[model samples]
Structures are given as C-alpha cells and as structure tokens.
Target: MKTLGLALALAVAMPSFAAPPVPLNTTDVDALVAKPAKGTRIIALWALDCAYCEQNLKALADWQRKHADVDLVFVATDPMSQSVTLEARLKAAHVDTVPSRAYAESTPDRINFLIDPAWGGETPRTMVIKSDGTRRALSGALTTARISKLLD
Candidate 1:
C-alpha cells in the first residue's frame, strides 16, 4: 500500500542517534534561551514513562527534515541515571541524531519550574523559542496543525 511505503521511507530517513544524553541543568536551559543557536529552537521535554513522547519525537523529527531553520532539542526530564532508558527510547524514535539532554539534578519539580513556571510537570511538553526572545509552548501529543501554529 502507499501508506506502507511512506512509512518505510520515513523509517529509513530517520536514523538513531544512539548516544548518551548530556546532563541538563536549569542554567543550561537559561543560557540557551538567552541566546538561541539557530533561527528557532524547539525544546521537547519528555519522560521515560510518557506514552506519547516517542510519537511526538518522530513527528517532530519528520517535520525538522523539511524545515532547515528549525532546530529540535530533546530533554528527558527523568534523572540522568536513566540515561540508558532515555537513549533506548530516543533510538527507537530515530531522533537520537539531534542533541539530547537528561535532567542532571534530582529535584524534578524545581527543574520543571525553572524551565517554565506555568508548566505543571506535564510530559511531552514542547517549547518553541525564536531568536528574537519570543516563544510558544504546547503540551501533549502535537498535531501537524498545532505544530505549525506554534511557529506562526
């Protein structure tokens, strides 16, 4: 079927990063937002237990393939000790090609607060920040339309 071919092609196009994630502290996030490295940075916050995170990652990775200016950064909110699981999950999604991070500190609540006080410790939270100090966020499994809206 045509859908099967498309799926196979997407799988081939996306390769696993398979590398361990770097440690992520609040300071690191603050510094990145203060000076984004690319035209737009999309920070995806996910956890090992979140069922929808992989789907979001795969979709976002596909979108990134089409948009050269969009940078996708993934952060596992789980503790750094779970790097093995993090790496495995990211590999499964084929989003290991991009830079990834794991929560370095143990205080998840505080880290989440530092990332965004408005957020309520939700999984699969996505933050889209632009170079001009403007940003938007959406939590939950993102739809193509919602992802597009975040950029606009």
Candidate 2:
C-alpha cells in the first residue's frame, strides 16, 4: 500500500509538458481566416506586446461574456513557434476564444504580415475583419460599447 501510494504521488508530481512552437506565415493565416464563421466577424492577427493589445484582449473577454455567439480568434505573431508554444501560451493565458498561430512560411499579403519586427514583438496585435472582406486593424484597449459599435 505504501509503495502504491508513493507511485501515485510521483505521478501526480510530474511536470506537465507542452508541444513545440510553430512559426507563423501568410498561408496559414489565409487558411485560418478563410474558414466560415457563420457570418461572424473575424479578428485575425499577429500578437505583440503592447498596451492596446491587452486592452483588446480584455475587451474580447468581456465581449464574449455577453455575446457568446460572437467569434474571437487569437494568433501568436511568432512564426518560429506556431503550434505547441502558441497553443500552450493561449491555454496558459486562460484565453477561451478563437486561437491560432500565424504560418511561418506563407505568401506575402497585406494583413497577415506583421506590422514590424521588434520586441520578439509584443502580443495582442489584432485586426477586425468583416464577412464581406472588409477589415480594420485595431490597437489599444477597447470597451464593450466600442466593440458593440464596431460589430454594428
């Protein structure tokens, strides 16, 4: 019984392992955004460290709380670590909305490409794209009222 108990304790104490990172690229971004959202708005973007991004994330959390039907996609700007690292980061961050990583090697386009390369770059940079292919890049924190207005 003591041996069994020790074994169980050891198993419980084992550290959790996460998957590796996948790089972000344009093709992956296109593929991710291309999927239908049943007419919901899509926020496809590369993440970076910035105050505005945090505000947007917080706003998204609040928005999802009220409008469960609305969709919120998250993509890490890191092209180097796309899959495991990105997924782990999202999970760790407690982000329970749309999540993806930019493809590491993708064709160049206007939106998917990062605005600039700096700071490993900070996360939370986002773009609000409508169903009709219209898009608006959003920076800085947002409020529920602002989100509603944008959705409208």
Candidate 3:
C-alpha cells in the first residue's frame, strides 16, 4: 500500500531522458541530404543563443504534428559537446521525438557551406529539401505560413 504509493510518486518525479544528439560533420553532409524525404524534409539549423530559433522550432513542431509525412531534421549550430543543452531545448519545443544533430569537428563555416552555400551563416535558418533536390534556404523566424509554403 504505502510502498506502491511511494513508487508511483518516484516515477512521477523522474524526468524523462531524451536521446543525445548525433554529431553532424562536413563529410557526412551529402549522405544526410541524400536520404530522400517521403514528403518535404525540413533541415532546421539553430543555435542556443538565437532568440527567434525557439519560435521557428515550435512552428515546425506544430506543423509536424498535423503532417506525418513531413520529416524534420534539427541541426544545432553549437558543437556536439553541447548536446545536453541542445537536447533539452528541442525536448522543450516538443520536437525531440524526431531526434537531432550537433555540429562536430569541422569549423562552423565549412559545415554551413556544406549545408547550403547561399546560407549566410544565420541561426534559425531552414533548408527545405524535397525528394527531387529542390532546396530552399530560409533565414530568421520561420512562421507557420512559411512552413506551409514549403509544401507548395
């Protein structure tokens, strides 16, 4: 009786652990992008200090909930060593279910160029890649309307 209650309380008190972010490197960029999305894939690039990044993440997460076919791949601009912080942020945004990656080894510029040469190295930037290889890179807060337009 008492033990059961105590066990339940402990269970409720425990925080759920999300998987650590995988390391994303320059050499692996092509392979990651090569895997086609069944529908449209969103490669969201964000940084911990970017204020608008959170808004973009939430908007994407909301869209994902309503669209199962949309694949989300969150890439944290910060190094993989900061996976804990990145994971926590993604978890809070409710997008951790899709998993995420953090930059590794290579310099940030190299990774940025590899992701998209036109990407002006900005946080909250998104790369909309379709199966046919048409890619659109957007910078700043990505709103619901902008996310929807990607499908169009």
On lDDT, the leading prediction is 1
User: lDDT for model 3, on a 0 to 1 scale?
Assistant: 0.83
In model 1, the worst 10-residue window by lDDT is 29-38
Error of 2 at 47 (Å): 3.1
Error of 1 at 12 (Å): 11
Query: What would the per-residue lDDT of candidate 3 be over residues 35-116, giving only the tens digit for each residue?
Result: 4746778888999999999888888878888988778888899998898888888888867776688999759898888888
The residue-level lDDT of candidate 1 at 80 comes to 95
The TM-scores of all predictions, comma-separated, are: 0.85, 0.56, 0.84
lDDT of each residue in 1-152, candidate 2, tens digit only: 99999999999997555344434555345655553455554463545444365456656866766775656666555555446555655556555344444546533233344433222333454455556665555444567766766666
Candidate that scores best on TM-score: 1
**Candidate 1 wrong stretches, greater than 4 Å:** 1-17, 35-38
CA lDDT of 133 in candidate 1? 77
